[model samples]
Target: MNEMNETGAHCHGDAAARVAEISGLFVSIRQILAQMIDGIGVPDARTPKTIIAKLSELQSAHLKVLAAEEAFHAQQDAVGGADTIDMETIRADIRGQLDRIRAAQDAGPLSGGAE
Candidate 1:
């Protein structure tokens, strides 16, 4: 990694972290939905009201996820002008691309450009 670009490496790490956060949030949202579904019938007094609260929480969670995704995209866009930028990074496939880029760099320039 000493040869790889710092910002590019950070971009990949940040994207992966943000994506994992979003995925965890989605998991929570799914659990809430499942709870809501489970409480469909039954004479429990936690019906409609509980469902409404869960829905509101779910909405908030989704909004947070969206914001995280937007921020992640903005970070990637900021890195777009860098020489280290590659098609994989552009396509949001950071892991694969960065790994390949590091490998390429280690192997020396394949052609003329600084891959």
Candidate 2:
């Protein structure tokens, strides 16, 4: 059963790694959002444009993470049907990332107005 244990450990380790990577992506997105907010007062469109580009890059990374998470879920479900896994934390993180992105989008483009 040592091989089984090793396999299980590997699976868990992989899952944890995925979670950590996704979490880091979300954190980076949040940081970009904050940077964008700070960009609002820069009085230069170029600054905000750079910030927006960074945000877009973060968004792309987030999408990639979401895709990987979805693939992981699909594989787990295929292996064990509905009893496959508890991916709630990962799902929650994805949702949180989405909400933050939406909020940042809704905040509107950076403005030159005074604080």
Candidate 3:
């Protein structure tokens, strides 16, 4: 887990928006793992350590993508660009990742390894 420094009191409007963002993050994570599992579909069903490492790397990248999105949103808000937030574009990008994850899942277990 990454460390977040909490200094000033945090402020946010619209509880629903916060909830939505959190929900999206979790859904994205789930989708990512599911895709990994699918791509690495177990004839043996147990992910070996190396495969697990790859999954962790993928998760880290996914989190970075989410954090970057949040940072972009914050920056836009700070600069009065909130109205220009291209939610559709963001969603589309996420959808693309999800699709890739699914394809990877379909690729079956990692090759050249004893799980």
18-45 per-residue lDDT for model 2 (tens digits): 7668767656766765666555444445
lDDT of 3 by residue, 43-96 (tens): 345758888777677777777767876785685467663345565687689899
Top-scoring candidate (TM-score) = 2
| Winning model by lDDT | 2
Clashes of 1: 0
TM-score of 2: 0.37
Residue pairs that clash (backbone atoms under 3 angstroms), model 1: none
The predicted structure with the larger lDDT, 1 or 2, is: 2
C-alpha lDDT (0 to 100) for residue 113 of candidate 2? 79
Q: In model 3, which regions exceed 4 Å deviation?
A: 1-38, 41-45, 82-115
Ranking by lDDT: 2, 1, 3
| Backbone clashes under 3 angstroms, per model | 0, 0, 3
CA lDDT, every model vs. true structure = 0.66, 0.68, 0.66
Higher-lDDT candidate of 2 and 3? 2
Model 2, residue 81: displacement in angstroms? 19
